[model samples]
Target chain A: MGLVANAGDSRAAVVDRPGAVAVAAVLGYLVLDLVVKLSGISVFFLGMQVLGGSLELGSLLSMVIDGLLVGLAVGLAGIGLSMTYSILDFANFAHGDTVTAGAFLGWVAAYIAAGLGTGAPIAELFMLNSGRQLSTVSTFVPVLLGLVVAGVGSVGVTLLVDRLTYRPMRAAGNISLLIASIGVALAMRYLIAFVFGTQTSGVASGGLRITFFGTVSMTDNEVTLLVVSLLLMLAVHLLLQRTKLGKAMRAMADNEDLARVTGIPTERVIRLTWILGGGLAGVGGYLLVLESGTISFNFGWILLLLIFAAVIVGGIGSIYGAMAGGVLIGLVDSLALIWLPSGLTRAAAFLVLIVVLLLRPSGIFGGVTTA
Target chain B: MSQRATVSAEVTLPDPSERLLAIRNLDAGYGDLQVLSDVHMDVADEEYVVIVGPNGAGKSTVMKSVFGLTTYMGGEVVFDGTDISERNPDEIIYEGISYVPQTGNVFGSLSVRENLEMGAYILDEVPEDRIEDVYERFPILRERSEQDAGTLSGGQQQMLAMGRALMLDPDLLLLDEPSAGLAPDLVEDMFDRIDRINDDGTAILMVEQNAKEALRRCDRGYVLVQGQNRYEDDGSVLLNDEQVRQDFLGG
Candidate 1:
């Protein structure tokens, strides 16, 4: 809170003339810093490499790719969070658990589908203990089936949760709803732990790797994540732009009172919002597991903060902003390894978030609402 | 036209069969705080009625009460013979009435056509012809159909808000302060458009802060002071009455 006050105070002081000058100076310094570091040129008087001896070209490229891979997942997950915040007007803490729920439900379905008639008991398959190696190439059908189940199952979970919790508290203030969501989040996280056990386990195998033009290389899972995320993102874009329900959602977000006066069924819109947000969170979680080749009971719970950082950075209520913010935070988190240790990368991503808030306040698309 | 200079105490209401909207001794307010009392008024079929008064006169509240936005403390709001005093806004909309609020009337983030599309959301399908009709009435909106409503000028936004309300083609249209923030030049243009809409057979129940101009144009005018009806008369009679001039029109 004090940090926010100080940032706001400094912004007020630099309100008119010197603000532009200060911004330009800071931008100029950063550009120079980037040029010096990327070229690997050492400023001799300072000793040591300029910015820790310019990174190896291949390593830097790989770090960027890794950042994008993580960022895409974060962005995909953040979309649901952003949509709910815009329309429902609350930060749903249970969203992270919804992601976890999607992964568990999806993986179980995938296992059951893949191991059918393979002499494995249904109980073992349900427990995902068939001991079969799953990959994009080896079990393509199962992986695809898992993605669908993740989305659909998550939608069901969110709708049920909304009916049980949020729907009843619909008339409450934002702060009260927010607190209720925290309680929901805790219950969901532990319920998943109890059901799936608390251990992290390997869930996928490296199926294939494609080297593009003898230079860039990517795993088959990474390719799958990229393609699926892009397609889903595109689908969301079309839905918002081309569909009636999508327009009604945006209109309701813009003005709920006017929407009601115009005869829009606001309750129905709210239900659809949960469905969309929950489905996206679930699909994103499954994709994250597919790319990383592992799954844990609380992976989504832990990833929630990073997803939040991405959403806040992008502009909390804007879907496109969440995507852009996710990629930025992802790149920064991975690229921070060039200067800071891997353990501090999360802190670096938060630092970027703070800087963005200080500068733009409303975020990249602030005041623009949910477009 | 024969009922000229009728004071609030002896105001004569139209026959129930001829009335499109009839509010009888309606009392309403927001959540426990009453703002209106015994407010009786009527808008017959295709009639243009305006309610004008000073700040806090509950002029807007009366419009809100008619549309089921305010708390129904007592009395009844009958529209085309349906008792909608306790109905919700969604239910009231289906009763052939549409309301445009004084502020935040248009969906700022939505495109022009999208805003119009949302106005017709109660219908299962988008009425493309209604969109065409709204566009015809306000050609500027058609030119900027793809643009966000937020980017429009104040006058254009007012037109869009009215256009959105017109999407349902309701028999009674409630407009709350249509010329509230418009430029002096554009105010007359807005009033002219309202005249054409009324001419095309949509009865208008409007509340306006510009009392004199509203009285000058509407077929009938009601002067509401402190939430109660003070005077009800033909527009010109209210415009010329000495008592109304002194108390409201600034003699």
Candidate 2:
């Protein structure tokens, strides 16, 4: 009994100690410094290197830009995922596949429009591999039109999925819904593979490079990705903060039963939630492929793991947390290439996620609900 | 319970034409699990009715069934003369009734004002006058209008929940256990607020755990047991009844 008492008292003391937190922070900083040292850049402090100087200045800037591009897409996509989780009460496994569907269809639309009158086989153009050079700069109208189609297409698909699968099981437990989502995920993935084929293919080409901060230069597609991501994020923010539907969504997320009795049209709000989430997922998918100039049947599936890490790190069910977490994960993963193997950057992102969780289990945004 | 046979519970029953809500032979539950049997109850326009009983007596179930939250196994729930028995909550909102659950009654993440805005979500525009009225009713909520509902004290949250329900200015309000988690001193204050709302002409159908106070305050009182109505009468009659006083009011 005395031993238990001593341990509990010390445990409380340790938890309350500010110095322990400081030590953890310092250790994290030192580890980051060590990782930076493993890279090639050079910097010195007191005749020894203890800070960043691993990559070329231009290379560093370019990586930052790349990270931001990836981050914005992930953040935008994660918003829909987070909203559904908060309101619908489950992690939608099909969300990643929803991304894939949007990208594949958006590319198909763009290819058909751009390759029209080029004498390419209509079959190849329709399948999105006619090789007709489809960069945003050269084919602005088709690309822009494709982006809109992506958003609308995903909403239609998501609503259909909800009506068919999730809606009937609304009264079911979260685990049951989660399992259903996993089934939805596998089916959607296989369906996309069946249509688009398994081979990874290139889409956009020859981007127009523009200067950033007088040091780093960004391609036209990158600029498009950044602008579109920023605008979408802003729009989502405005809709959630200023609109009645957004408040209803938040209210439902907070307490579905209470929302019901409070005269909120809960089913209608649920529909709105899917539309917003599905549209964002679709737009995010399109922007991601545009930024990388590459598309594959299962690319979105693979990207889901990293996106989960970001959402978990930021705090699941928090819209702002998902966005902020996406940026953080993207920055860390991209920047870690200095100290980590290119392939191991994803691992490093997960490690950061684990560390964040160890410190705050509810996540940085968990308690904040849908806000 | 031995005095159950001698109880005179029909005193001061309202006329059918004057009632705001009428539940006839209500048999409802969650999913396929029935929690309420054939139960008949009514709330007249501008009347204050309180249902009090022991825990798990299906008091809250009655409120849930009235709001169309639970599964309607059978029976009818007509509100303000509309047959709303099979209507879902989305359709029920148009019937001009509001419910406040015991827990999670407020949208924790939304601000007090936002919570009120959400109450009128079915409306095209936010009713500024209704919001102002809520603020006037709960002045502390007015001071904390920008604060998140989750951050509020239990009593404040209760006030905000009631205020949100009042945003629609409904003909009837179904409040479940409004004083459940309140501090002891604040319980009477919460009751005062409900009285004021009733005094303003909104018929209130409330379920409460504090039987004595609920009976003392309301115009009518109901005692339910195991999903069935046990007693129904004027509040004072129930308060003075020997069986009710001993079995429910903890004599």
Candidate 3:
């Protein structure tokens, strides 16, 4: 009997270490995530809902899934953010405005497609109408069209920004660059508001909801968003880790002079970096609109702090760090209402960012610093 | 002192020669500031040619001008019969002129193998056989192929820089002060490796501050003063000249 008890106790001890580790990881993630949500001012509605005792297993799962999607979206945004840091070596203050511009373009393209009457080759393929019925495959069509429009808009804005603002500022160095970028940001904000009008717009059509596990229901838009974000993040990861162009980008970030000496066309690489970074921001804007069903001229600007916090927490110029940081920030922002007021969630992210900056200035992942 | 004599003896050996590289009246410098003024030099295809001088003698500027890093005010830089003065650095590299700067020379964040791959960036195609050949020459690099270049020792980093430049199988290699901050023993080993590099058929045009040692290893030597070539002679003749030895070599 003693032998049997001893064997059981030994087995229990063996299992306890892994269990403790898993629990610790989850709890740590929860606390960090809560801080981000509070910092972002998103915990108000969440607080009310939780206080009303309306949080059920199904609701919790749905919230978790929503948080996951947001995290993935932010991670995708992180790739673009990392690239921006590489090219300019400073936060492109106008980046959020560029995202809004892409969103506006996506909206315009969808509106134009809707007006051309369904079934015309271009109209039928690209249009998103409120009353239109979509088949399983057709559900994917609007998102793709949105992505294409956003990508083009992003590349155009990026080029323009480089020509008008970044190029001159780069020659002048850091402080002048910062001022110019801020000027571009403010100018872009007003420009987007003027063109798109000062009203909110929705990108998703009312569609059939797919129910899973007899309790979880998701719309076509949400599923589209989640899948698209995942695929894009995967593609970006592969591009940065596996390709020659990616290696060149890393090298430039490490040592620009050495990269130039090694035959890397520095100007071309800079252009490519802008296009890619701006394009990702554009996609993030479009995804946010699809998920929330509403977007305004200030959509990206409002999210700027959260995004900045994510990038900073992850470490500047580190793609993997950005992704991890984005997801972590997103989860916290989405779930903070569980324990705190909604208005304070966003600020929590900033607090965490401050702590990270103070403690580990190199960030969670050690970033490559150029001499 | 006896050990120094033996190392100097080890450096005096010579090999067969062919035309490696030639530069004529290479006037080049940064914007508005002339660093090299009408300097002329040559290295037989398989010869080691070292340019030695004081700190401000423009030795590095000479290498930079040849590699197209600096603008040439006038004169021709011919490498393998191609006039490269008008070409960009990458184009010059394609024309078989490889340059390794004095400091921060390697891409620090890249692995040893990646640095080597980047060395051959100008080539339309990279032959795997050449990589294996370089590995055979620097076995230490092979052991640390996956390690970052920045973590390597100064001497090891210099070797990696040279190995990277050789990846394109260039006919001529330009080195700027390879022994800049090495220990005495490491400097000796570095000179020996340079001699081996020359023996393997790449002509070397190097700027070194260690004048006596540089003069001991090279077939010919040039002394530059204030961006102009002041003296040129056979290595042994310069080593034996009283004035050359006193003024430059600190003998």
Candidate 4:
């Protein structure tokens, strides 16, 4: 009975304070183990091999690169999620489906543009598995057009959704709005599935591979994703830092009541928030497809958990926090492959999120808000 | 002060035609919770008016009602001969009035410059001259132009809030408890700044918890008790009245 009580107390303590010593021990062990494995150094305790595995330095480098690319996509999408959460004061569950919508809209445009002169039927192009090859190098114009369309089209969809569903309930409590968003998510998901069949398919042909430092290799699509995501991130930074509308957004996020009294058109700001966020999610979704060379109806929905994990870990309302959290979650998701199977990498990411929340409930950028 | 008091006794208020703002039979409050009932008040052009009251007396509610931040049950808020009781705050701002809330008035996470810029968000371009004027009035804000408002001391934050409201260069400015959270030393300095602003000819409507000090400084004062008007007189008369001093002022 005494032993049972002690176990229960420790369990309760983990929920309250979270055993810092235990967390540190686990983290230290993981680090030490990773280092040992990377260095190919074995540890022997009492004539028994306790730690070490053959992890190549090259493989680790590739993991980091892979993690960075995926992180950029997740981070880009997270910017919109974080903005809406901050400005709208609700967790929009439909955000993931918005991404899916962007991907489909952009991919359709790309396919139709690329197969324009080809004798292929319009339906085959719409199906996105046309016999004609398409890649960044082969179909640059089509890809560019697709990216633009993705952003603009998503903006339209978000605005319409807000007008039809959210605006009427603007004064409602956060829970009502959140639950309403969940319903929106379901409606959008099924609508997309109905319009574009549910089956996933490879859409892009592999482009040129660029080698970096004579050691690391990256695909042309990956490089494109890198440049575009970085440029868009910079644009976002400028918008938030230098523009009047952006400052109003930050101010509204800081204190809505004050914003209203200060004579800011709250409705206009809300519309702009959706426009900016929807645009980012749209572009981010298109770029993810560009990198992965595949398109699906539900990829965005599947990616939603990871996006949310990033947002919460970084701090819900902070843009920079979302970016940082996205990269961290992405790196952890990829790097965890070293120990766990690829299927379980998502689980590893969530474990890290749980640990992070237990350590700092507000997240890494909690107090700083939208700025 | 004595000579001014003698002149105020035979007071010739600016004609009602020149009144900048008039609140008649005002009834307003948060949804389902009435706070202000049949409240009547007025501010003449360039007039400096202050509202003083005990806690929960609806002084702030009156200010908010004028700004259209509260639900209007029945009232007429006329500004410059235009009925504006039905207008929203955004529209009211265009009518040449600006409001500075008692607290959370400044955008804490934004830079001082950004906070000031947000104040003029309704304008097509950033008015550099008005920004300069605000900086000239509050030199500390100029030095901390790029710093976030949240990092400032309470006194500095209050100054920033005032500067933000001044960005639009409104004809009438409503300030709610500008001295509420200031250190005792800073309160006098804050009141002096308001006096200077009013002296420059902008009509001032303020609600202050610092009754004695507010009454001493305003041209006219209104004593609101439990959401109803209790007294209206020249600041000097209210300050000297035995009943007013005993009940509202901590004599």
Worst 10 residues of 3 chain B by lDDT: B1-10
Per-residue alpha-carbon lDDT of candidate 1 for residues A203-289, written as tens digits (9 for 90 to 100)? 887689887656577888888988999888899889988998888888887788999999999998888888888999999999889
Any runs in candidate 1 off by more than 4 Å, and if so which?
Answer: A1-41, A129-133, B1-12
**Estimated TM-score per prediction?**
0.93, 0.90, 0.81, 0.93
Judge candidate 1 at residue A226 and give its lDDT: 88
TM-score of 1: 0.93
Model 2 residue B46 distance off true place after TM-score fit, in angstroms: 1.4
Q: Per model, how much of the real contact set is kept?
A: 0.94, 0.89, 0.43, 0.81
Candidate 4: what lDDT? 0.88
Clashes of each: 0, 2, 20, 0
Task: Give lDDT tens digits, candidate 4, residues A173-289.
Answer: 989999999999999999988887888878876578888877788887888888999899899889888888888888998999889878788998889999989988988999899
Q: For model 3, how does the per-residue alpha-carbon lDDT over B1-251 read when each residue is reduced to its tens digit?
A: 11111112233322212245667768888989888877777777677788888788999888888888897799877776667787877567667778888898887878888788877766556567778888998899999999989899998899999898888887888999999989888999999898898888888898998888888988888888898877777777777877777888887
What lDDT is reached at residue A55 by model 2?
A: 51
lDDT of 3 by residue, A1-371 (tens): 12223666656754765443444455666655445544443343644622122345566668677777777767666667776776557777787777788877776575455445544555333323343433224455555676789878887987988997788667676667767878888899998777556776555643658899987888777787788877787887677556777667777777777677677777777887888888888888877677777778887888776777788778877777777778878877766657669898777667667766775787776455321
Candidate 2 structure quality by residue, lDDT tens digits, A99-191: 988888888888888887888887898777765657778889989988998999999989999999999999899999999999999999999
Name model 4 segments beyond 4 Å from true.
A1-24, A46-49, A131-133, B1-16
Off by over 4 Å in 3: A1-65, A88-90, A114-138, A163-170, A205-219, A368-371, B1-21
Cα displacement (angstroms), candidate 2, residue A52, comes to: 6.8
- TM-score computed on alpha carbons, candidate 3: 0.81
CA shift at A105, candidate 3, in angstroms? 1.8
Predicted structure 4, TM vs. truth: 0.93
